[model samples]
Target: MDKANADFTPIFDGQTLAGWHAVPRLPVSRAPGGPEPDRTTETYRRAAQTTGSWTVEDGALTGRQDPPGCGYGGYLLSDGVYGDFELLFEACPDWPADTGILVRASALGSQGYQILLDHRRSGNIGGIYGNGIGGFHGINFTIDAEYDEQGRPIGLRLEDPATTIEPMTPDKTALLNDAASGEQFLSIWRWNEWNEFQIRVEGALPKITVHINGVKMTEIDTAAMKHPSYRQDEVLALLGPQGHIAFEVHDNDPGMGDARWGPNAACRWRNIRIREL
Candidate 1:
């Protein structure tokens, strides 16, 4: 596999996390009456638990909830902020792990646009989400798990068959384009295996594009985006033109039988390189 090549520079040293820091991550929203609970107190408590463990294993950067099955998660953030760049990385997440790559993230790490790597029931991958700006889901499909006889996840399936491509609607067409169909995505995706991901983000209200295993996933023009809770001006002010790149481990759901991260599960990432635009 060709790396970033001559035009890009490597960010991760492969031996150590020299330019990164860990921070507690939480779900947040900027919309009124949008489940934006007062988690400030909870956040303080969580920060004390752990920056959930981030370590280098087998040459890959791995992240997991400390002590596993714990309700909280964390983020590994780049020390420097970035703007208008293309990033390339490979990911291999354990089944049911809720993970993501964050772009233009705030110092705290949760406020940004996330490219979902939520490998679990009713989750979507290769989609854009408003991490803390509004919780907007810029996606058209959700992936679920297929189980073996003992109920261990053996493979994946689309939650809704119709979402295989999700027929283009006027509203969706206006916000995004060049999307890969669920069929197209599944055809190339290797279950329980490493997959390459490419993300390009540019401008303040950027146009975000994602490719998975060389398949064009989707493109979102934030400049023309329309969502009830997402205000371009407000998000721009909050995130600014530059922010840190972050790797996320989502908080475990407290509800009965709804685990976001599989017990002892971790997400592995490597070959992280970037090119400034």
Candidate 2:
């Protein structure tokens, strides 16, 4: 309430998906070099045939892959575009769901700055990810989920080195200079419950800051950071000064031991409020 302190507005109506639309989740990882892949037509086609399901149930926006683990993913994006704003929302995802909140997103939901809400086994939350902008990860640690015999999520573990794919080295640490420790995040995060997320996105090339349950999680300055694959000029041109906000339902990879999204399970969102700066 304090950071995004005043003049807040509600983007979601709590009854329907009126001011939002669906789009296919596109490739967020691209190799450095060559002109950006123009997937406009492909994005449109996939959107028309989107297999993800979005609905408002009990006043909470719920999203899940249709037919439960059909390997399809999509994003529900706001119809209006915004620049330099503060967004607050509460999310409660089922175990094993790879989801996120995307800011500065293109119409097709291909490109954006993402706040990772990867609520799955050996996944992480509140991290900064470059969506279709070079695949840079700006986070200090990882989180792993513990499940009961019935396959329900029981608890969470912090910074499991064995499951880490991108370790925090000197370079990574320098790039993500304002990262919160894993223990700091774990101490505040409430498992299997509705957790509030507050995000501040500003500037042409944004400096994004994320807070979970009122605790600062991480901050990334795209304008100042450098990555092997990230091109600031290219991203600015592709996304422009303002764009839509989107929620993602990640594609299920059947090869993985568990579905990226659970079977018939949905991630719930509510109290989505925003304040434009």
Candidate 3:
């Protein structure tokens, strides 16, 4: 919102991406005589089979999702890792779906912070995903679902407590209470409409500030998170270098869950940008 700091520079001039490299999508191996194919393999195949589903149009980079295999997304990453930076972007999900902007990813999993764009009326919008303080940091919110032995949802946990004031699990895995504390941090926007998202990261101190539609929603202190893989110095060293920025299009095939109105339902995106601070 303020003038670019001395260490910051624009990565997208509102049209084409600058100071960033396009990590062209690559393909994964497929098994012989497999049933249909796994989602990851299909996703990588789509990326390799054609130019990415993303395109620069009308001063914005757009991501389009096609049916069949829910792959082909958008991403513009810095050539190097940045310990501190501010990322800004505007996105609009297709009539009935959601998407996410993932930062500090390890090319293995959603490790750092994810700005969620949920469209369902169920109130899962604008939440944070993956490693963060207080476990699953973001707007305090909860979903009712019963879990199987492996932690998979078997049915809605009707008796589950609200999500606020629930301390994160010791391993930083699950949210514990029923008070709805996490839901208080998000600013919900219109579904199927463009909304602005801002994320600020200070890698050294490992702090995060999230703003949605001009409303400051949550600020997380990573130092306080339950189970960290390393100490402050180690974390800083690992994250100090520039890393990849990615968009997560979770597997939403029909059998995975009720596909109606879920991420597999539909989704679109445009106008993505990031600046290194």
Among the numbered candidates, top lDDT falls to: 1
> lDDT per residue, candidate 2, 1-277, as tens digits?
6645568889999999988998766554463345554657755355447738999999999998865666677899999999999999999998878899999998878678889998876567888888888878777777777778997669787746765644545665566658788789889888889999999998999999999998898888999999988899988998999999999888765355344677766888998989999
> lDDT for each of the candidates?
0.82, 0.81, 0.48
Selected candidate, larger lDDT, 1 vs 2: 1
lDDT of prediction 1: 0.82
Over 4 Å off, model 2: 2-6, 28-48, 149-151, 163-171, 254-257
Overall local distance difference test of candidate 3: 0.48
The list of candidate 3 runs beyond 4 A from truth reads: 3-8, 17-52, 66-76, 107-111, 121-123, 131-139, 142-188, 227-241, 253-276
TM-score of each: 0.90, 0.89, 0.59
- Of candidate 3, the 10-residue stretch with the lowest lDDT total is 25-34
- Residue 159, model 2: lDDT of 45
TM-score of 3: 0.59
lDDT score, candidate 2, position 75: 92
Residue 128 error for model 3, in Å? 2.0
In model 3, how many backbone clashes occur?
Answer: 22
Could you tell which candidate, 2 or 3, scores higher by TM-score?
A: 2
